[model samples]
Target: MTIFWTIVGIAIFFVGLLISIAWHELGHFATARWFGIKVPEFMVGFGRTIWSVKRGETEYGIKAIPLGGYVRMIGMLPPAPGKTLGRSRRTGPFQGLMDDARAQSRLDVLPEDADRQFWTRSPWKRIVVMFAGPFMNLILAVGLFAVLLMGVGQATDGTRIRDVSECVVPASVAATQEVEQCPVDAPPTPAAGAGLLPGDRVVSFAGRAIEEAQGQQLREAIRVASGPTPIVVDRDGVRVTTSVNIIDNEVQDFQDSTRTVTAGFIGVSLLPDYVRQGPGTVATEIGSMIVRTGEAITKIPERVPAVFGAAFLGEEREPDSPVGVVGVSRIGGEILAQENVPWQQDVSLFLGLLAAVNISLFLLNLLPIPPLDGGQIVPAIWESIKRNTARALGRPDPGPVDAARLLPVAYVFVLVFLGFSLILAIADIVNPVPFFG
Candidate 1:
């Protein structure tokens, strides 16, 4: 049953991925048509075409590989200097590359497409067309997050006691054991000694009530107390007051396990709680996700060594480390196979994963490197700047910045990206990170 659900989860994620890819290409396709650019193909994948149909001048299709997709727009790059379409007679050091790029850009150029080439459009229109793809991913991410956070709600902990600890032990000792039960020589937990039971709704701790959601006051009071502290609970509709002897215990630091601090301890776990968030909270979460993802993307170069070590050597991969498409899909499968997980929780987690994937897509494609949407955008922006400067200096419009000239750079970008992707893929397969554990 677990295996069946896991396969189902992978299939669901793959379908979601295809939808995301198609949605991204649709952005480019729709905007290119809107700006009068000749779109020759709108494909949902790469490599050998599985199916296709010609509609007007454009061919819509699906391909074998489901990794990525693209829309082929006419004249994506301006012609090479002193070179015309189908009459390329140049072979300088890198001239042939630029010429080939220009030639390929004109592959679907018909007589009417002369005016419909992407380069013929205004720079602003080109920018819009290029920007639309990433924007679609951003829209999908926000919508998913809104549905998960506002509609489904986030799981948290409440003030009610789920379980009372049997023994008092240092966090260092607790970390070494699977279940820290009361030893014959060890003392019982403060909550256990104080006669606190499961299902007790903690009304106040040391005169402090629930400060914020998730029983913040109780946590703070437990951490700060030095000795016996007064606690009030509502047990079975009756208010009960009790005192617990707080013990000085070694607690593990939240960020670093090597570090420890002495704090008050009264061992009791909180009951499961959930709080449905508002638009403001969802927006905040989205902003944080974007910032965190951007930081992670920037750290990719630094992480290559770690990825290499994990893939080649026997080093364990970090839980929060970067993952490729394969890694994320495996994680989706794992999420579905989790033992005893509720259906709603599984769906929520799947939605969250999809949202994260879209967020990553939004950020990665916006990078100012060639072959990506951002690369095309850079040329358009430069063209706009040059045209404005020419108007100011009483010069003629220099025309579209010869994007063909950057063909070599774009090729390099593709190679580097391919190399990085290959490494991540290998690492994902060999040393997959335990995302949840």
Candidate 2:
């Protein structure tokens, strides 16, 4: 049953992936047509076409391999200066490459398409056509985040007490071994002695209001104080006040998960709550995610070797490390197959995962390197500036920037990306990151 659900989850992700790809391509397709550019095909994959339909001037299709998709706009790579369009010679370096590209680019370009070619458009229009794909992903990402935050609610670190411990013991040591309870010599925990009970919501601690203080701030206040301290708890809709002596004890550090520290112990467990968020909170979270993703992108080169080692050498994989599409799909499936949690929780997690993936796609495609959206955007903006400056200086109209020369660079970029993609795929299968952990 678990295996069946896992497979179902994987299938669900692929369907979502296909939708995202189509949405992205639709952005480019729609905008290109709006700007009068000749679009030959709008494909949602990279291999042989398994299904296709001709609609007007464009062929819409689904291909065999579902790794990625593309929007085929005629004259994306303009013809050589003073050279006939799609007429490539069998001489010079990259001549064959240019020939094949020019041939495919203008597959059905008619004589009337001379003005309809993408190169005939002004630089701003071309920039919009190239940037529209990633921008669509960004829009989707924001919408997904808004849904996840407002609809599913956010898991918050509130001041609700889930449980109370009777005796004092180091949580680190307790985790390592199965000790039934604290030893006879152990003292009563502060919360237990102070009559703290399960389901008691902390109203305040050390004269600080929980409404203003949150559970973490109250925790820090408790950890820093000693002697008699006043705490108010809301039990069964009634506010109750109590006093307890905070004592120094060895326990797991709340701030740093991996370390143990000696701090004031209260012996009560915090229960996280799911709270609704407003638009401002959603915006803030989106900004934070963008920053984190940007930092992760910067560290991707450094993390590849670790993934490679984990895949082949049986090395431990860090949960925070980079994950590929396969890893995300596997994790999504595992989330669905989880037996202990509610199905709603699985849906929330999957939505969050999809949101994150869209965010990544948005930023990655914006990278100012060849073959990516930002690559062409940069050249288009530069060409616009050059042309504008030439006109302002009473000079002749500078021709469209010949971007066909970047074919070799784009090839190298694609090859390097393919290599990394292969490595990440293997790592995802061999030493996958644990979703629950």
Per-residue CA lDDT of candidate 1, range 105-167, in tens?
777788866999888899999999999999999999999989988888877656888778898
Error of 2 at 195 (Å): 13
lDDT of 1 at 222: 86
RMSD of each: 3.8, 4.4
Runs of candidate 1 with Cα error greater than 4 angstroms are 1-5, 51-57, 84-91, 154-156, 160-169, 174-214, 223-249, 253-258, 262-267, 339-349
Off by over 4 Å in 2: 1-4, 84-91, 158-170, 173-250, 262-270, 339-347
Q: What TM-score does each of the candidates earn? A: 0.83, 0.80
lDDT comparing candidate 2 with the true structure: 0.84
C-alpha local distance difference test of each model? 0.85, 0.84
Best by lDDT: 1
**Which candidate's TM-score is highest?**
1
